[model samples]
Target: MSPYSHDFETLEDSLFAMNIMILISMALPLLNVLGYFLR
Candidate 1:
């Protein structure tokens, strides 16, 4: 396998992780608001 491909895979993994973090960050506040309203 090529070194460039390996680097690209690592970059993709990091981006995926960042996306998950961003999604969770966005979701938490919404969840909190939902819980507050539901309560």
Candidate 2:
């Protein structure tokens, strides 16, 4: 593959990883809040 495609692939992978991390972080806090309210 071309260097440009390789760079884009790496960048896309990184962005996807970052998005997953953010979602996990958000979900944990939201769950904690719900648990506190329920309990």
Candidate 3:
């Protein structure tokens, strides 16, 4: 069995990936806030 045969992925590549995910998760709220303020 080769290591590549059962490859698993992780979200521990870089702090940037974590930060980006956080940013993405918050995008909806941020947009909602903007819409609320604009309205």
The number of the candidate with the highest lDDT is: 1
Candidate 2 least-lDDT 10 residues: 1-10
Candidate 2: residue 29 lDDT (0-100)? 93
**How do the candidates rank by TM-score, highest first?**
1, 2, 3
TM-score of each model, in listed order? 0.96, 0.78, 0.41
**Candidate 3 minimal-lDDT segment of 10 residues:** 4-13
lDDT of 3 by residue, 1-39 (tens): 666544533334556688998998889899999999999
Superposed model 2: Cα runs more than 4 Å off: none
* Candidate lDDT values, in order: 1.00, 0.98, 0.75
Q: lDDT per residue, candidate 1, 1-39, as tens digits? A: 999999999999999999999999999999999999999
Off by over 4 Å in 3: 1-22
Superposed model 1: Cα runs more than 4 Å off: none
